[model samples]
Target: MKKHTYILASLLLVSGIALAQKENIKRANKLFKMKAYTQAAKTYETKERTQEVLQNLADSYYYNTSLQKAIETYRELFVKYGDSIDIEYHFRFAQALKGVKNYKEADEHLSKYYNKPVNTLEFIEANNKITPHNFKLKEIVNEGSSSDFGLSFYGENKVVFASTRNTENPSYAWNELPYLDLYTATLTNSNTLINVQPFPEAINTSLHESNAVFTKDGKTMYFNRTNSTRKKTDEARIAHIKIYKAELINGEWTNVTALPFTSNSYSTEHPALSKDEKTLYFASDMPGTFGSFDIYKVAINDDGTYGEPENLGETINTKHREQFPFISEFNVLYFSSIGHQGYGGLDVFRSNMVNGGFDKPVNLGNIINSNLDDFAYVIKEKDNVGYVSSNRTGYDRIFSFSREENPLTKYLVEGVVQDKNSKKLLPGALVEIINQSNKTIKDTVVGENGYYVFKLEPNKLYKIRGTRQAYIEQELEFLTGNYGKSHNIDINLESLVSVEERIHQNEKGELHVQLDKIYFNYNTSEITNEAAKTLDVLVDLMKKYPSMKVEIAAHTDARGSEQYNLNLSKQRAALVLEYLVNQGINKNRLKSVGYGETRPLNKCIKEGICDDEEYDINRRCEFTILK
Candidate 1:
């Protein structure tokens, strides 16, 4: 009986220990759900490496941008639970890999998650060559603040930014930092913050406030205000953010109110005002969004009311988070996105306004964008200066940058193809840029606007050749200089009819090189003295317009056997092509064909069908411009 008692006691002790561990895991899960990643990670680190625990732990490190730990944990998770792990983990794993510049491994996982091959390295290389600007960034000095971002220009010399420097406020669950507040300061020439002061109690509430934008007059400001309380949603308890307007009247800010379109169920934050103060752009996750968040714009009416908010469309939004939009004076839309091809977490992108709509976004490249989150891009187009936020240093920090035209983008040539006489746009004209080595470097067909552009290199000589069917080719040679130089080489191509009266457009709209009749030896594919003289005129015309491509077609009379005539005509056409090639014309620019008794000038399809004059009309060579 005593022995049985001992066994029961031992079992009871084991049950109690197991129950305690279960309770601890439950608490950790609750913290994870609350976005208390730091604390949850610590708790999960002490737990067993179960699938759930490992997933949560890896996610915690990833969300915190502790990438090396995230990578290690994620790798372990896959090794232990590769079969049961969700596919979403692959995307996170890829991002973690990219965070450390392991793009090769990251692409493997990204390819699986996206179900398509991903080449991030190539994208980065190409972006570097074509991005419009190269930035020189300097980290702003904030002596005491560990996390601060979203710096915006306020009036002439002042700047406003969001900071977690308010230690008095309660800690945020996401990063355990203090709740964010709006702080204003005068920016020094050395990019240091001076006289930094938080906004009045009205604007700097206990809740998170950030991403402030002010009108040019500095009388009105729009900013983000996080909900004081969390509301239970299907996914989790979310504290939705709303855009609030604060009016500065008589030197005091008052009349603070949330925008009517903002809701407690969804977030609408990161306000940016257009130059005219007529449009208010912000980021939102409201209904009809293409992703977790999308950039939106609303018309601020003259009566101080706003029109319905409009999504920026798919060109700017993607199936993942796209936020922190900033519009410059030039009407360029600068935003951050994760869904579009990027290095890793949110990379800053720019999209120019074309035809009154935003074009496809271009990645800002690796200079200002890092593998971690970089956002809140604001710039002064005239000054070529800007401020952007990035978390590459393990904490969100603000950077001031001075930009110059990208050297790679500078050495380029652009212009329109036009008719020499009418000055009308020549659409569908082929333009080729050839290097000093006589190799065609690039080529493009002019669009409806007749515009053509090609990127070139510095200290190099290039020739721009413009050509269209039956048009006199134009070639202009230009040399590029260093330090971001661009040249406009407008090509005015002349028509063949304008230059050569012999060239005529046939009824079928084919341009024919009409030459005097040539007499050839009977049933032979040889060029006679008379034929040489006529071919010389054709060669001179081809040399004058080097871009022309011509087809040499030979026809035969129907008197000879059909097969014999076909072979003779083919040989004659080939001889014409060879003659042109020997006369310094590129062989690639000529084609030869024989239409023996198949395409007669007159209705003489068979032997003895017509007189000799009619047969002679069919037995001739024709030169037609192909391009």
Candidate 2:
């Protein structure tokens, strides 16, 4: 009886421990939902490795940029629940792998998730060639602040930035840092922040505020403000953010109010103003969003009213997060996106405004973008300076950069296309830059001035080709010098007038290539040995000018019925064309036509109207150059 009582006691102890573990898991989940990633990660570490627990743990580490731990946890989760895991987990796992520069393994998962091959290295290399500018970055020196970002210019001398430097503000649940507040400061020439002071109670609130933009006159401002309460959505409860505008009146900010387009159900943040201050750009996740967050724009009218918000569309949005939009003075859109194929996390991208709409976005390349979150890019285009925010060093830090034209892009070839003999500019000519591998890097048609330019890379072998209709193609092979060096390579295309002279015009005034008489056997369309030799000359000419097109015409005597003569001539012309194709001429460049007895060199229009010599003159083949 004592042994039985001991067993019951052991069972109760096991049950009590299991209940305690369950309670711990519940607490961890609540923290995770609250976005207290750091605290949740520690709590989850002590829980059982169920799929749900492991997924949350890995994501917690990933969100906090603790990539190594995230990678390790993700590996275990995939190995244990490979088929059951959601595809989105693969993307996060790949991002974690890439954060540590493990691109090879990360690409495997990305390829599976995207259903296509993704080579981050290739992307970087390609972007380097076209990214117009290279950046020289210097991290801004912040005093007594561990996190600060979203630096924007204010009134030419002062700068406005968001920071978590206020120790008295309530701690944020996301990172356990103080809630963000807007601060104004003087950015020193040596990249130091000085005279830093928070905005008055009008702009800086107890809740999170960030991403401020100011008007040129410094009379109007727009910034982000997180909601005081969380609203439940399809996935979880989220604290939606809104854009607020404040007017600087009588040396104090007043009339602070949320934009009408903002709502409690969705977020609208990161406001940017156009050069004319006529349009406002921001990031939002409201209805009709293509992804988690997309860049949106609304026009600011003359009376301060806003037009209907417009999404930037698929060209600038994706099925992932795109935020922190900054429109430069030149109307170029610079935004951060994780949806577009990037190094790993949010990378800065630029989209030019062409024809009054944003074009395709291009990654800013590796110098400014890291394999971690880099966002909040603001730039002054004319000044060639900018500021960007990044979390590459485990904390959000602001960086100021000076931009210069890329040296590789500076190494260019420019010249004019001219007529070789006439010394005249050959407008509408095609100028192509081909690499050593015979791949065309760039091509352009010269305008009225016959001038063209192509950007080049250093230490590369390239050939410049100039081509025009009825002209002999001119190609010059050259090697590129070092960066900042350029070449003037004028392409002088020679006209094919000499070749055209050999082409005689028929009595009908149609141009036809004059070759030696081709003789086929009597009553048969078979190509004779003598005919083959004559056709070889035409083959050689087409080969010399690859762009040349030819049409072979065969005419027969009018002795037979016209239909019979037409059929026989077509067979003869087809045979000659077949021979030319066999000799390596592109079939597309060759055409065959049977004039039959309809066209005659002499007045032999009907049977017995002329002698054998007149009939023989009509029964000959003529080659025509189509192009």
User: CA shift at 123, candidate 1, in angstroms?
Assistant: 1.7
What are the RMSDs of all candidates, in order?
Answer: 18.1, 16.4
Where in model 1 is the C-alpha error above 4 Å? 234-236, 410-627
How many angstroms is residue 624 displaced in model 1 relative to the true structure, after the best TM-score fit? Answer: 47
Model 1 lDDT at residue 413 = 82
- By how many angstroms RMSD does model 2 differ from the true structure? 16.4
lDDT of 1 by residue, 1-627 (tens): 999999999999999999999999988888888789999999999999999999999999999898999999999999999999999899899999999999999999999999999999998988887678889999999877999999999988899999999899999988899999999999899789999999999899999999999988899999999987787855467788999999999999999999999888889999999889899999999999995899999999999999999998998998789999999997899999988999889999998765568877888889889988999999999999989999999899999999988867668689999999999999999999986657676999999999988766556667889988878878888888763577788999998888899899988879998899765566888998889889999899888777778899998888889999999899999998898889899999999998877898779889877887877888889999887
Supply the TM-score for candidate 2: 0.68
Model 2: lDDT of residue 343? 83
Global lDDT of each candidate: 0.89, 0.89
List clashing residue pairs in candidate 1. Answer: none
Which lDDT value does model 1 have at 220? 91
